[model samples]
Target: MIEEFVREKILNTYAKRTTKSKELWEAARKVIPGGAGSGFRYYEPYPIFLKRGSGSRVWDVDGNEYLDYCMSFGALIAGHAHPKIVEAVKEQLEKGSMYGIPHEKTAEYVKELLRRFTAMDMFRLTNSGTEGTMHALRLARAHTGKDKIVKIEGCYHGAHDYLLVSVFPPLSKAGPRWAPTLYVHGEGIPLLTVKNTLVAPYNDVEAMETLFRKHEGEIAALIMEPVPMNMGLVLPKQGYLKDIRKLTEEYNILLIFDEVKTGIRIAPGGACEYYGVDPDIVVLGKAIAGGFSAGAFGGKEDIFSNIYPLGHAVHAGTYNANPVAVTAGLTCLKHVMTTHAQSQMNDLGEDLASGVKAAVEDTGFEAQVPHIGPSGTVYFTDVEVVDYRTASTYDKKKNWEFWFSLLNHGVLTPPGLLEGGEQWLVSAAHQKETIEKALVITESALREIK
Candidate 1:
């Protein structure tokens, strides 16, 4: 009855406030699948339509302003419409947007990326994280001369068919915890793709080793997010990464750290620097380009030489390293996301996490906030979520109610938080006061839901 009451109350409130968004969703659904461009952008009833954003805040079509903790799913780590990004885009626009030929800024961008990601000796850009991971996997397979690859359960590298297995499998069909059955995330994934992809649980080194031993000399790489953000910000167990690195080396399998969500948001050098374990390749996107559509993959010079114009593996894109994206990314990484900005965002993340933890204790709510640097999420379960299996214990009803309550209170989290696949990101533009305000709103929402 309480859950029903909460849902009804929130739904009614949401419908009244977002009437224009409803109309837009109706129109969009007539043309676009599911009334939104991306599946993650849609929610029950309808999704709110936004007009514009600036500096950690977004305004909806209805003229309602929200403190944007979602930060465009951590893609806007420097915050929306940053002055530096705008200036760079304008300056680059004068020259051109896309050029199929090599440009100076592309080299500079790669150089900058290498400077931060010291583990990477060479780099290449792509249009999105999907392309980066796709290319990275191809490189891995080519370099190792193997077809099969391993993916951690619940880790989402990209929408590519090769790594789309077991992202959010139903526990009933997921088999044992240690060795999970590879459940294709969608219907269109080829059977051959599923056969080539393997599944392993997170935070368990023994299980991974079992998989490695069973399929020795078969796997090309083990692709994973260093801090599994796709499963509501799960943290890696202490020394788990280092052990995985050692294991991969022993088995002669390439380790690909998918840092699309964690690259710029977690640390300057991302998980590689934070964990101090270099993988064979690293895929980066999201915040790396300061909200532009860009992704990159890089590693040792020897491994990267597998790409075309050198080796047989072909990686090419018309929009790859477009001047607009490169200029924006260069500006963001070089000027905006400075050490001071990184420190400020990290401090704000800690503050927000601590505040949420305190709020949970005070409200007697069953929840845990796992955080690192500028990313975290409030899982509505008493258990600390170290992996996808534990993360599944979160009460979906409570999460939906809480998320709706926050939206009603002018705090925007990732829409997919209701489905336990997203996390809140603190941007450099986020001030301590805004974090404090968000905490107050979160506490109120938790109390109401409870």
Candidate 2:
């Protein structure tokens, strides 16, 4: 059983500390569904309503400060209100917010992205990652002339109907391991939408090949997160990406890497550069715009050439390349997020991971902290979490205890919207002292659970 006393104590402390947040939540629920903008921001009790942030810290409505690791769900890699990003946005705002017509910043920003991701010949910008992935899939289907698409079991591309299959299904309804059944993640997703989307186990090349063979020429593309963050930062096993690339080529299937979360955070070129594997299409979002709402997709010239004004495909948006977002993104990529900054952030991530792992061991907790680049997750399990299946075995009650304890002690990780594990993102603004303090808090939380 969960330590009821410990749980109650932490909840009591949190409730007392954030009295203003509770009041705001009650007022917000009348208009906003679930009292929050995104479903991921809510929790069992009420979510903490934030007021403002600067650097690696944030203040809630109650004025309680926290060393923020959530970092806008891993989008603010340069940290909240970084001076460079703030100045860029301010300068752009003074000039203008949006111009429906084309602007010079659009080309300037795309050039910076292309410089990092050399594999992409040309790219198109959208308002968000969802739009980027949606257009990318349409292009893939048009280029290959196929209707079906294959996706990893737990990988999340976006909220679009076509890619929402088998995100986090119950094991009882998940079918088998190798050939998993596709279950619609939520309501409003039509049965016809999921019929053509195939599901395959992550980290299993043979299973992926089997799905390809079974579907044959019907499958147009296989889109997945090179290192899945939605399922708690599950890394691709050794040679897993390379093998998948070969298999896709052999089957004449388009390989699209949905790097929405991993892009710009993992490396300059994202997973393709870190893993040394080139995909047909790469979808980027999050940190690319330095916390602004933005998305981009790029690939070989032949595929994107099929877009409007060139071919028959239709891809258009009024805010396709918003000048404000482009200016902020360009400033972040060209100035703030340099090669040296990425290396420093990565080293900080390693330090945080090691420190947390040591604390777990010292406390005799059956847990593991797996990290890559600047992101990591704390899995409350003894076994190695290779994929979603293993990650699902984590202890939920312990997870809640750990998260609540951290919050009570002034540290903020991701709210428990995702079930498998909890991820902590180290930002460029976090100093070594901040990491040490977080580690100390983690040890205290683990001890309280014990």
Q: Could you tell me which 10 consecutive residues in candidate 1 have the lowest summed lDDT?
A: 1-10
Off by over 4 Å in 2: 1-6, 417-422
My TM-score estimates for the predictions, one after another, are 0.98, 0.97
The clash numbers for all candidates, in the given order, read 0, 0
- Measured on C-alpha atoms, candidate 2 has an lDDT of 0.88
List ranges where model 1 is wrong by over 4 Å: 1-6, 416-420
TM-score of 2: 0.97
Candidate 2 lDDT tens digits, 337-374: 99899999999999999999899999998886788988
Best candidate according to TM-score: 1
lDDT of 2 at 325: 88
Residue 18 displacement in candidate 2 (angstroms):
1.1
Clashing pairs in 1: none
Q: At residue 310, what lDDT does model 2 achieve?
A: 80
After the best TM-score superposition of candidate 2, give how far the Cα of residue 150 lies from its true spot, in angstroms: 0.7
